[model samples]
Structure formats: C-alpha cells, structure tokens
Target chain A: MSQPRNREQTEQRILAAVGEVLAREGFTGIGVNAIAKQAGVDKVLIYRYFGGLPALLAVWGRSGQFWPRVEDLIAEQPDVLTLPPPERLTRFFSHFIDALRRRPLTLEVLAAELVARNELTAVLEEERERWGQAVATLLGGDDAALWQDHIGATTVLIAGVQYLLLRARKIRRFGAYDLHSDASWDALKASIAAYAQATLVRPEPAGHARQDKP
Target chain B: MSQPRNREQTEQRILAAVGEVLAREGFTGIGVNAIAKQAGVDKVLIYRYFGGLPALLAVWGRSGQFWPRVEDLIAEQPDVLTLPPPERLTRFFSHFIDALRRRPLTLEVLAAELVARNELTAVLEEERERWGQAVATLLGGDDAALWQDHIGATTVLIAGVQYLLLRARKIRRFGAYDLHSDASWDALKASIAAYAQATLVRPEPAGHARQDKP
Candidate 1:
C-alpha cells in the first residue's frame, strides 16, 4: 500500500511540474530533465512511470489541462441544448472565450503550435480534435440543420474567436477593441450574440427583405 | 557612376537574399552572415549598406513583400467603394485572401509572429498596421455606419480569414473544410459573403424580426 501510494504521489508531482514549467517557459522549456528538476525526483523515475516524454505529454493532454473538456462547458449551462440555436451558440462562444482566456498554459501551447510541429503539438492537436468533435456533437450533431447548412459560417466564427483570444496573448489591440480590457470582451460577447442572432435566425423571404445592395 | 551603380546593385542583392533565407529557413535563419553569403558579398557590406539586420528587415517590410499593399487590392477592383457595403466587403476579402495566398514568404512570417516577437516581427507589425489602417480607411474610413456599428463582426471575419489561411500552412483542414482545397476556400469565401450580407444589411425592425429564442 505504501509503495503504490508513494508512486501515485510522485506521478502527481511530475504532472504538476509540467504545468509549472509550461507556464514559466512555454513549450520550448519542456524536457524530462526539466520536469524531474521541477518535480524534485529522479529523471529515471519519469521513464519508468510514464514511458517517455511523448507518453507523459499524452497523459497530461488527457488530464483536462490542455483544453476545456466538453463536460465542463456543458456543466456550466445545464439546459444549454434546450435553448434556441442562436442563444445556444451565444452561450457556447461566451463559455468558450471565457474558458480559453483562463488557461494561459493552453494559450502558450497554441501560440507555439503556429511555428513548431513536433510530438508535443501532435499530442495536443489530437486532444483538441477530440474536444472539438465532442463540442460539435453538443452544439447539434453534424447532421443537424444548423451545422450542415451553416458549417462554413460556424467555422468562421469559431476560428475567429480562437485567433482573437490567441492574439490577446501578444498584442492588446486588434482593430478598435483593446483586448486587455474586460469592457472590450463584453462588447465582443455582445457582438457574438448579435452574430449568432443574425446567423441562426433565417431571414424573411427575399421580397420583404431590405435591399441594401441596389 | 559605375561605383554608385555597383553599390545600388549590392544593396538589391542583399535585400533579395533576405527573402530567400526567410523562405528557406524562416525568421530564425536570418543573419548578417547568412544574408551576405546568399548575396555572394562580404558580411561587412550588409552592415554598411543597411546598418544591420533590423534596418534591413525594416526595409524589407516596407518593400511590400511582407504583406499586401492596399493599392493592389483596390487595383484588382477599381469600383470597390462604389458598391454596396456588403458587396464591397466581399470583394475586399476575396481580393485579400487571394493576395495573401500568393505570398508564401508573407505567410511564413505571419506564422512566425505567433511564437516570437522581436525586431523582425516588430518591423512587420508596424508595416501591417500601416496597411491595416489603409484598409480600414478604404473600407469606409472607420467612421462610416458600417464600420462604426459592426467592427466586432468585421474583426471576426477578417481575423477568421487570417487564422484559417495561417492554419493552412500546417494543417490541411479546419472544421469540415480542407484548408488546402480550393473548394474549401470557396466555401469560406461564400460564408464570408453570407456573413457580410447578414451583418451589413440590417434585419427588419424588432416587430417583424424572426424570434428564434422562445
């Protein structure tokens, strides 16, 4: 019992150390030696317990620290699906923006992925894809009208949200909004609401629609 | 006269070499020695001609190679401003995407900017800001009703396009669309047009609006 408990404790410490090193120095600083030093353990133990760095990262990726888990996002709004599509989208983006903003380590890895692709990013990418598919199913399975018809538009909104949040890590301003300010984010939320409202709601028949193009 | 011409030619060669090295090895590979060697010139000439790497990069940034020039986008569509706001936006994005996709070097730098910011990115940032301002002005001077009210949506669209394009360098797909596929890009463009049409053309007054949230 003592041996198993001590091993569990050491694994937890090593995992915690990955987060610390990641936050302090970004992905470039991650290594077995670094993690062992930060964990206050022998480097050999890491190989014995986790197999190697890729496996260690894989475990960390599954630990819900890399990206927001679907369960957590849905947990925040118990009746999310019951809401109308537009409101559901607004809530989804609002929760997503909030979730990503809170994870500085995740943001760092996202930034690193832009330039470098290796085992680390590969593991994170797989994790993100899993989360992405889960969220897609939650938002209305891919076969649903909202997703099937408007996937392109949906992609734009989602990719846009990601870019802006990632951009915030480096620059404070993108266009008229100051990314560092909460007020700006609030306005962004409102815009998301407006966009969702506009997108999800089908426009009235062409004859009665306002003709701005002419 | 020949001496001055020879000096001017040397400067051109050094500048061209910057683009070559950048395309080959990215921002990290750029150096006085590398650029000089690529140009078939002495390393001292790079300093004497451009005052060092930062200055050389600044010159390159201004050369219209690092990002699209507003003139080029407008040149592709001379009647851009006369069109309706939605159509104008569609044309602008279409041209913008086409321009960016053509410049692999610009794309490389954009990816690099996400991870590192230094003299190279700083110089490019300033240049991009200059171009961004010009674009804003061209798209309605930032004071028009379209820009004043819908900047958030506009940011989402523009940034989404950028993110997707930058993403294509690494991953072939984003969402349901393959980033490398022209058809996928066409779908994105149509989505942009749809989003622009929805955003720029105000929906009917609240009484007549479709209520999706019940």
Candidate 2:
C-alpha cells in the first residue's frame, strides 16, 4: 500500500517538475536533468518511469489537460444533437477556449511540442486527433454543422496564443502575448468565441479535404 | 542621359539582387559577397550605393520588391476621412493579403525577417510610422481604431504565413503553405477579412482601452 502511494507521489512530483520547467523555460530549456531536479526525483527513476523527455511529454501532450472546463459551466454532458445550434455551439466553444485559458501550461507544452520536431511529433499528432474529436463532438456530438470550416477557424483561433509565442521567439518580444492576465484571457476567450459563433452558425457546405497531405 | 539611366539600372540591379538572395536562401544565408556576385555589381559599389546589407535591406524591406505588390491593392493615398467604416477596413486587409499572394517573395522575406529578429525588428521599428499609417488606414481610415486590438490582430494576420511556416518547421511532415492555392488562399483571405469586418464594425464606443497590456 505504501509502495503504491510512494510511486504515485513520485510520478506526480515528476510531472509537476516537468510542468514548471516547460512553463518557465519552454521546450528548448527542458531536459531530463531539469525535470529530475525540479521534481526532486532521482534522474534514473525519471528514466524508469517516463522513459525520457519525449515519452514524459507524450503522456502530458495527449491527456485531458488540453480540454476545457465544461463541467463547471454545463450541468451535464451536452446532448449536442438536440441543443439549439447557437447556445450549444457558443457554450461549447466558450468552454473550449476556457479550457485553453485554464491550462496555459498545456498551451506551452503544445507549442513546444509543435516546434520540437522530434519523437514528440507522434504524441502531438495524437493530441491533434483528440483535439479534433473534441471539437467535432462540440460541433454536434456527430451532428456537426459545417464541421470542417468550423474546425479550421477553431484551429486558427485557438492557435492564436501559440502563434503569438512563435513571433515572440523570433522577435524576442516577451509580453507581446501575456496569457496570464485576466482581461487578456477574457479577450482571448471572447475573440475565439466570437469567431466560433460566426463560424458554426453558418451553413457552408463541406469543401474538399485539405490539400495538405500531412 | 545614358549615364543617369545606367545609374538607375545599377540601383535597380542591386535591389533586385537582394530580393533574389532572400528568396533562395533565408535571412541567415544572405551576406555581402553573395549579393554582389548575384547582382553582377561590383562589391565596392554595394557599399557605395547602400552601405551594406543593413542599409540595403532597410531600403528593400520597406517599399521594395514585395510590398509594392501588396501596396497596389490598397489605395495607398486614400482620403482616410472619406472612407466608410468596415469597407475601408476589409478592403485594405483583403488587398494587402492579395498583394501578399501576388508575390511569393514577400512572404519569404517577411518570414525570414520576423524570425531573424534583431536587425529586422530594428528595421520594422524604423518603418513603424509608415506601417502604422498604412495599417491604421486599413483599420478604419480614422485615427481612433489605430490604438486598439484591431491593428494587432491585423498585423498578426498579415504575419500568418510566417506562423504557418514556423509550425511547418516543427512538424516536418508536410509541404509549404502555398499562398497561391485558391482554396488555401481564399480561406486565408476570407478568415482575415471576416476578422477585420468583425473587429471594426460596431466596435466598442470610442474611449475604451484595454487596461492590461498583453
């Protein structure tokens, strides 16, 4: 019993450490040594449990940390099929953007994963699939209205923060995108929600699949 | 008279050389020797005409090979006061994007310029007055909208291709973001236009300013 608890504690510590390092230094700054040190876990145990930065991040990247906090706003799982398109779509998108705001660390890791271009790509791809499912589910729980374009607009809207960060790296203009400010967060939530509402309500036919092979 | 025309030809030749080198190699890859060789201009004259890459790029970066195409779309000398609210805004944005599509080289240079940071940022800062005026004209043709969120969004949207390229750099799983593909370009143009329309129309009553800077 004690062993299980100890193992859980160790894993949590490691994850917390990884989160801190990623939030602070981002992907370029994160390493096995940094994670272990921050977690206060033995470096070897980190290897044993998480494999490496890639594996550790795979779990982090693929998990529910990226999902919005819908439970707080909605009483229960939305019967997406039956709900009026506007409220259902708006609320769901609001929840989605809210979720990203709730987990800025997830945003950080996702961007880092995006740029890492390494073994993490598979994990990121899986996360992308999960995100699509999440968005599709929000679209109608299978009754998606204009799902394809809604998804494209959603991708761009949600991607705003990550995109800003990339600009920050190139220009080294920190604070250009302050993800933490409450007003800033509200504005982000508003911008995406506005975009999503505009996008999901319309009746655009499904166009061709993206020419992008990947 | 022939000598003056020859001098004009010499200046044009050197500027053309800058654009070519930037297209073939990224910002990191450009230097003095290559520019002279490519331009078929004497190495010494490069210094004489433009001083160096910094000066040459400073000039070229402003109204050179790429932007003129982009600028042609918007009425450069518009009577700002006469233009209507969203029409001026969306038209300016659409035209700017159209211009970006007209010449592939601008996106390439802008992409490299954005990522390269230091020197380019200084150049961008120098051009801020001109950029601001042009962007402000697009926002509403009025001075009020210039200070708000719309300009930032527009600038970022203008910078969207760079964001796409940077993300592509990470995945390494696909081809380039073709600015010319009708579907892709149309979608991109629509999104930006839609965003501009939404941002500028029925904008908040004049005096509101975001309290927090992000």
DockQ for each numbered candidate: 0.46, 0.11
Tens-digit per-residue lDDT, B71-95, candidate 1: 8987966867767677778888888
- State which candidate has the highest DockQ: 1
- Provide candidate 2's TM-score on chain A: 0.60
Best by TM-score: 1
What DockQ does predicted model 2 obtain? 0.11
TM-score of chain B of 1: 0.83
Q: How displaced is residue B190 in candidate 1, in Å?
A: 0.7
Clashing pairs in 1: none
Residue A20 in model 1: lDDT: 91
Model 1 over residues A129-213: C-alpha lDDT tens digits? Answer: 7777777777773337656656677788788888888888776677777888989889988887887776665445764433344
Model 1 CA lDDT for position A183: 94
lDDT (C-alpha) at residue B173 in model 2 = 28
